[model samples]
Target: MDRAVQRTDHDAIASKLSAVKRGYYEDEYLELFCPRFEPRLPLINIGTWCRVRAIDQAITEFLEKNTEGKTQVISLGAGSDTRPFHLLPKHPNLVYYEIDFPTQVRKKAAIVRRHLSQKVELCDSATPVTLEGDINTSRYHLLGQDLRQLSLPDLDESVPTLIISECCLCYLAPESSHLVLEYFASRVAHLSIVLYEPIGLDDEFGRVMAENLMMRGLCLPTFQKFSTLDSQTSRLRELGLTHTISAKDMEQYYNDLPSAEQKRIHRLEFLDEVEEMNLLLRHYCVVFAGK
Candidate 1:
């Protein structure tokens, strides 16, 4: 299987696992992955739920306040993510754009067409070629572009934009990641960027985490390069984003979540691995930057 396909497959599996545990919103489409992988560990399910919840909250807050003009959301490396479908009904005026490698985009396009043809519009057969691939669209536009090259689709700069990179940046080399950030910062006028990535790689747990990923031939090139809140904030600042805020870890993010919401998710599973969960949460961080 293609690398992009493999990554997306893993993501689908994770989503399905989290849904099975009832840790977040249900994604019935992810059930397609059930034959390939059994239920994932409770820890994996919880981690996936936390990440999804954080990003969802950020986008919700953004959409709730900025309900003017043509609101846009650009999701980078949006492999197998169904956020657009979830957001469309709430904000029918918003235009969503998802970019990823060609293989991933093609696969996702087919899936969306099969399941949501009535809701989305796939561009005509003669889709214009820019890089090595074309884009399919509806309310959501899914484009095929190499993140390393960083060529964004034609977009209205005047519109308030929300850019998301959930667990996506760590896969790129530090320079490439910076280039991606700089591309957006230079173009989008009013923008908010929400990044979810692993950090805290200076300790034993971090080392083990890094080694485990490496052993699977997965490289987190920018993990240690921006492994703390200060480094993450500084990176955004250097890239020209004005106001930046970062959570030290998921623990902080979880603490900051609403009490009712926290109780809801905690009740989803019988979590017994308190110590391990804390250590896991401490290794991941959420950073938000805007101009």
Candidate 2:
């Protein structure tokens, strides 16, 4: 299958799973919206949510520190996400630009419209009930452009900008990934990126996740591994992102869990027994920074 031609059904399912849970995206319509996208494994849902929570926290911190009051945000591959509604309440001065395929953008807009209408009934925040509605008017400017033939649009130099691509780099060919990061680093003054990837304990687990994705009729150009963190850091340095945070820093969040939960986490059967590295850390996420 062509890498860019993502099966809509599969993509929708992934989006649902990705968004739902506090500290996560909390989108409750996944099962109702796309039932055919079944997660064969049970823990997949919670595991994915935990990973997303980590990503959200990482990006939230970066943006809070790096973004100026008038900064703009570019969210690449933004799925059925509620970030505009969630993040904008606190940072009203910041402008957000969301980019995704036409279908996702349209569906998300409709949902935002419906939700905004019901916000008064559902939410307690004094933040205007129609804020989502107002933001929906300009929060997401749909861009149907593909990444391979991508270029930055013209914007003011004084406006500090941040580019985000959550769980997108894995789908990119290695060369394209490098070029895209370089492109973002060159265009933005202070930049930080959070890339949530499916990793393996070693090459073996990496291959397993790749195969699992392939079985779903998807292609993974690269499945990053925890062991390669050093190489990734070095590569980002060359790309002009001077700061980096490896998955190791976030390990504390998971490691500090209740003893029983940690035990359950360790027993996750997703790994290849032969892999020498710790399976949990082997396949996870990392944050990159460029100043």
Candidate 3:
């Protein structure tokens, strides 16, 4: 398989696996071979996990408020996300479109099928509901076209649409990310994006943590430019999304974990260096937007 295809495949598989098994470490796919046996920092994990939970809650709320029986959801780079099936119990008639590169989409569909089958067969009371339509489409329904030259049609102007980018945005060049956002806002009646990423802490500890991760041969983020909360808020203002959710709760969560969990978390270089940066080392976010 092509390298890009392989990565996407991994993305879909890893994401779903993480969500399904509550106790599994998120970086296990990478750390399985090289385990972090040392005590880890609980605060670090708490901070990161909190952001993810917040995104899930925000999307869930959006679905409950807007979905009457016919709303559509487009999860960009929808790696192994089970939100579609999970949400089905709440709103069985809504349609979900998980879009990604072909290989990822194929693998995710297979996973979903296998998971549903096991659920039905193993659990006496389990009831499975099918997601509507063919899984693959050359022209996706929302954009239904290549993103490079995206220009969404106005035919479905009245439909309530929610676009989720998640952690996928930071990987794209900022310009490309911005263009995609612009396209969605223009086309969708309502839109929400959840971004989780590393930002510059500028403190000595923050810098050291990031560098130490690189030294340890972990995935180093290619894009490292981070803006202050004010700057980030301004950008969203330009895009007409004004709601904000700060990730500061994550730091607290990590710090509050029991001693054993804290050890696993503190082992990571980033967590150890957080305090050295004048408390600037942290996770931050903005979730509010208007159509």
Candidate 4:
């Protein structure tokens, strides 16, 4: 299961790469993380775009609102995501952290050192570095730690932080996923966690999606556990993020965007399967919380 989860990272990067190549969004540093590439299905590209769009919206909102002091963005189970690179330079006071399995972290570290070593200015702060524990750069710490047993000594509760789980925590056992959220909510005073996961597992669309994933050795333990947008937000509330919470499915997300922006994305892809796109979008939702 661990290995299967790791392979999803590759699929994620490939999907992103395909979208970028198709001009869905602009990312100067994204191609550095993708080693393998192939034209993916339009459904896959559409799903990838929704995932990035929702998470990016949550992140931009968090940083814009918390502009007073040093802020941090932590990506849980971050795999080949180039967000830190894109965000760090734009927000000078921002510190970005990526946590994943040890093997994944090591792989990412090598890529960072080889391709982007000189591109990003390393953080000069003394707050410990987490690049496989061998490097010390607070600006971008790449920690290789399992979310099931995550431990961080440098997290400052006083500073506002955003945690992102883009189709990440869904892979864990439902109880473990709750524990991971509880661990952070208990430690961080001002926090918001954004989650993107498939819901409505009792529906036929979900059952077929589950079967398709199962054939590829991928499974979402939380699909049935937190089966709806309400349940996703409820998990955040149960974990103590009771202040502000919101949930939106991807179709709603796209509709909520500026009309011009929505049209821009629509023009990028000739999605003939409009019904399929709508069906897929309804099954996945973004559940966010602020505290």
Candidate 5:
């Protein structure tokens, strides 16, 4: 909740504007979770927002191009993300699945029941069970599974599948990350994988960033392993995916975006720290691969 507020208030990320209202108890918890800094660092928030926008755009384009068939979207480590509700109205054929830790899935199911009961259906719950751990609805499904031991339910190979892993893969060891990627790649015949994760940890800023995350007891084991566009694309190809594409950082992505949209977001915030923002963006990337 606090992180969502940071994106909306400080970085001017408009997609997160509805986060507080849709997220139960998020408004009250924001006071405790909000950062103390007066002028928050916009780099992280910008990177996050850019990543979301990029992924959203990719999904939109995919849906646009493949309009005839039913599409399935699986969000790995999808924690309290309201994208399923947001997307269901426009794309009725889209089936959304969110996978996360058991506790996180339970909390999200409870919140959705309380706030969005009319729009969503809870699985096996008489009155939308909140305390329960797993969720299975017509349009949305939530599973409790550790990424290291990820075992997805049987899905149709004929239907095009989109697997999203936003800031989730970096937490796993390199071997584990490959295992998850290969698992999905081998099963899903028509599959597209979109990944957002931090890279470029060999430099000074990257080294410092790694140290900070380590201090917080969070390690990015794959950052240094697949740190560049070439490495990222190569890794996917090695895992049996084809037609891979990657953005080195948000700067490249922003440049590829519509000029009007770029102008609009640039006007939202006064950014004086260009060098720092560039360095920060350069350390993160978005990689897309399909088969």
Candidate 6:
């Protein structure tokens, strides 16, 4: 296994921290994951803002429509994600499960024990926190399990579950990614899965993006296979899996946001790389699939 892939977690957190620092969004918990973050490029911050807010939109829509009073959110390869911190307390009926590598999980445990005790209610307050790769609380569960060898622990199959695969599963082979989706599609009935990944990799801009990542020992296997929004949607409907699927590029996502929000974000920074940013946004997309 290429452990270098796990280092992407740092990028995820740092980019988000950059966005937060620039006031593109509000994420108090993200700083706790990576305390010291040098601000990233304005372009990077804008992209991060769009990527995160787009995903947040998908998750928000899922939560609003499926207000069944009992909901479960499973984040695959959830590395230092602060969604649970913002969501768990707000939505009392929601239970969040974050699955990631053992080392990453334990890293989060150290921080959670040190800072999160006052906010999250522990599952068993009497039990001491160990060095193991698992954290249990009333509203959140951080599991130390590899997605390549995924054996889920105690999932309520009947709950209206929303699975988030944000830039994680693309590291795997296309077949492996499909298997991960199939695994969940088979288990949950009222299931919705949202994905944030790079697409349109066949283009010149996309090629440059791929080369840039490759220089850092990273590979996105779904680059060519699901390179377009249609392919991304088709992959979700593969094996007769999901019923409804919506796919949109980051540019479209930004346009879809309320005009006031777009104006507010523009005020945060001077975006001199509008053309470059649009190209980068075109190469990436956000997808939603529900069954």
Candidate 1 lDDT over 132-204, as tens digits, reads: 2344444567887878887655777888888999888888889999989888889888888989889989999
What ordering of candidates by lDDT runs from best to worst? 4, 6, 1, 5, 2, 3
Q: What TM-score against the true fold does each predicted structure earn?
A: 0.88, 0.70, 0.62, 0.94, 0.83, 0.94
lDDT per residue (tens digit) for residues 69-125 in model 6? 789999998999988878877887888999998999899887887787566553446
Candidate 3 or 6, higher lDDT? 6
Question: Candidate 2 lDDT, tens digit per residue, 1-291?
Answer: 543434533554564463342123355445433545444332444445556566667657766775555766677776654555566556755666666656655566556556543441223335333422213323334344456666646444456666676666666677877777777777766666666555442667667766777787767665542235555566677777667754442344455547886555445445343223335444665555556
Least accurate 10 contiguous residues by lDDT in model 6: 121-130
For model 1, the local distance difference test gives: 0.75
Displacement of residue 98 (Cα, Å) in model 1 is 0.6
Candidate 3 error regions (>4 Å): 1-45, 67-69, 114-155, 205-226, 243-281, 284-286
lDDT of each: 0.75, 0.55, 0.48, 0.84, 0.68, 0.83
Clashing pairs in 5: none
**lDDT at 177 for candidate 6?**
84
> Given candidate 3, what's the lDDT at residue 23?
39
Report the C-alpha lDDT of model 5 over 157-248, residue by residue, as the tens digit: 67888889877777778999899888888888888888877888888998999898776566777887988767877888787777774545
| Best of the candidates, TM-score | 6
Model 4 residue 95 lDDT? Answer: 81
Model 6 has a clash total of: 1
lDDT of 2: 0.55
For candidate 4, the 10 contiguous residues with the lowest summed lDDT are: 127-136
Give candidate 4 misplaced runs (Cα > 4 Å): 123-135
TM-score between model 5 and native: 0.83
TM-score of 2: 0.70
